[model samples]
Target: MKRLLFLLKKEFRQIIRNPFMLRAIIGVPLLQMLILVPAVTFEIKRLDLAVADNDRSPDSRELISKLTGSLFFRSAAAPLNMADAEAMLFSGDADMVLVIPDDFSEGLAGITTPRLQVLVDAVNATQAMLGWSYLTSIVRDYNREVIMARGAATSAIPGISTSPRYWYNPTLNYKYFMLPGILVILIIAIGLMLAGLNLVKELETGTLEQINVTPVRRWELIVSKVIPFFIFGLLDLALGLGVGWIAFNIPFEGSLLLFFGCSAIFLLAVLGLALFLSTLASNRQQYLFVAFFFTMVFILMSGIFTPTESMPGWAQQFNWVNPVAYLMRINRMVMLKGAGFHDIARDVGMLTVLAIAFITLAIRAYRKRA
Candidate 1:
């Protein structure tokens, strides 16, 4: 126990001694949570729409009115010809162009499908899908209203109606879906980077070698190193979550204890990876490179910005090894999905496996070094 205390004391001293490194470890994450929480969004709103209303009929004019009335889309420009519409898209002036072809109303009159062409810029695929879907839905609704008012049920105009009930986010607010994932990412980035840098600093200043002569047991040394990072991670997690609830007004419907419990497991894996990297690196510069490399890979594959299921099979398999992947799912499930213990069991189990694996590898590395 005395040896454990010594190791713990030594680790804390090492952290306090390095000013820039310590600041970076704690400060960057806080700043990131502040900036990125608003930037990452799933909701597509106020999308710029250009229209090519060639029909020029009452029905087409009504269609334009519906487009302008949508909460998602705003008419950015007056109706243009097809050439000008395509030109506007080419010039990045619009996201979508609604081309009501000249024969559209005529087709409705001549007992045919009245085609409404939607020209979409798929560069931002998610937004494009949302915009087009909203447009289509509005047009469909308008068509039905026109048909019923005009008694066109006898006109035999076929239409499809839809009733959608959003599960968690009723208004499809981007903040609701985004805050949890951003918080998860901030915690991981902050925790792992800090832990790795802290561990590697001791090696750089020859502090680790000096301590090796002492009779400190391996587990004591490991736990001592992890405890500070664990606490720091816990604090960052708290601040991010608090901000999400207070500043952003995101929902906290699920168990807070469950969220923290999962965070604890992820922190173990991060600190373990840090310790393992410290064993491999002899100086601060090498540690930075190694730590940054892993951090980049971890963040990119975390599914905070993208879905893991959308990845190819090989990449999905790769994500299975990432601790943040599990954390990402767990965060969304808890905060957005309002999922209970039963729903997140798989995520918890995966994080457990990753924590054990990283810690085991770290222990092996530490033993080899000692």
Candidate 2:
């Protein structure tokens, strides 16, 4: 135990002595919090819209008014024809286009269900989805209001209506949904880097041979290495959560202790994996390359930007092994959904299993050289 403390002190001094690595370990998390919190969002208001109104009638004008009245639409881009609209769309000048046929007003006056064409560029699929949904909703509301005013439901019939209660994202703001997930990423990156460097630094400096001959038990050495990086990971999570509150005004709707506890365990797994890779690789360069490769795979599967349910069957099955994915879902539930532990119990269980497995693998890899 005394030997292990000496080794832990050595690791601490190494990290403190390296200026560039120290800056990276601290700076990256802050920089990401400042820049990316805004960039990662699903709320898309003030979108550029275009109207090609051939109807040019009162009813048509009213429909256009409805579109313009929406808070989401920024302004209408002018286009003369379908070709012009197409050009505007491709040039990124317009996000949504509404083309009202010339007979739209006449058809509406005749109680005809006018076929209003809505054109959306799905390349930026998130905005396209929001625009389409908003358009459909506004049009539907207008139709209902018109029907009620005209006493269209004269029969002894009832109308069935529906309302949506968005659970996690009540405001539907993207950053509120993304900040917690982004924190998970930062912790994973930092944990991996720190873990990967620990043994390689000792090996590179020829200090590891001395430690190998010491009286320290194998488990003590491993725990000493992991404990420091695990704390580093927790620091990142704390900084990120703080920045989200101060900078972006993202709310915390669940127990902070519970969330941090889960995050710490997840980072334990990531740090262990990094140590495992460090054991496999003889040098820092190899560890960096290997760690970088797995980082990409883990983030891609983490469901930060995409839904895990949408992934291919094999890929989704594969992410069952990803700790980041577990954290992403659990953090979002805590932040956005205000979900209790019951909502994320399964995720918590999976993360615990992954942590145990990674720690076991890392210890096994360490002993193989014995």
Candidate 3:
């Protein structure tokens, strides 16, 4: 216990004594959160729409007004013809073009279906799909209003109506969905860099040989080295959560102590992986390259930007081993869904298994020999 405590002191001293490392611990993640969180959103907003209205009737003008009034869409000048509308799409001036045929107003009065054509720029398929959905919803609402205004038989055919209640995030704010994921990324980054580089730095400076010659066993060194980084990981998590709550107004729906406890376990797994990586590299540069490669794989496969279910079967299977994925999943579930420990027992178990496996692997990988 005495030896481990002394080693922990040494590790903290090294981190505190170095200005660059201190800034990295504090500043890097802070800057990344401020810059990236707002930019990372899936919600489609402010799509430019061009109208080619051949009807030029009051009904047609009403439809155009509806489209322009929507928060997702903005009205650009009406194009002259299909050719001009095509040019607008080609020139990237319009994301969607709505064409109301000449008989649109007459068709409504005559009890006939009006012909309306929509040309959507599908360069970004997801954005295009969402934009089309918005347009269709507006048109459907206008159709309902028209039927009501004409005093038509409302109960002729009652279509199926759905009342969707979005829990936790009623407004569907993208930041609410993304902030927890970003916090996970930041902690993983800091834990990996610190643990991976710490041993290599000692090895490069010839102090590792001196420490190895002492009475410290391999497990003692590993535990001592990991303790400080584990604390750091907790500190990083606290900082991120504070910022997320204050700046982005992220909700804390679950128990804070439970969240922090799970985060600590997740950090143990991440820090252990970093220690294992450290055992493979002799210097900081080599560790960096190796760390970066694993970092990219971990982040990409962790379902931060994409859904795990959307990945290939093999990739989804691989996510079982990814601590970051589990942590990200659990954090969001807890925060957004207000899920309890019983709800996330399976994931929590997986993280515990990973934490033990990684720490064991890191212990085996570490060598006292030069």
lDDT of each: 0.79, 0.83, 0.89
The TM-score, computed over Cα atoms with residue i paired to residue i, of candidate 1 is: 0.83
Identify the leading candidate in terms of lDDT.
3
Q: Which segments of candidate 3 are over 4 A away from where they belong?
A: 111-113, 213-215
User: Which digits, one per residue and each the tens of the lDDT, describe model 1 over residues 90-134?
Assistant: 887888988888888787675677898889988988888888888
lDDT of 3: 0.89
Which order, best to worst by TM-score? 3, 2, 1
Candidate 3 lDDT by residue in tens digits, 78-99:
8999999999999999999999
Q: Best by TM-score, which number? A: 3
- Candidate 1 vs candidate 2: which has greater lDDT? 2
lDDT of 2 at 96: 82
C-alpha TM-scores of all predictions: 0.83, 0.84, 0.91
Error of 2 at 284 (Å): 3.4
Candidate 1 lDDT at 261 equals 92
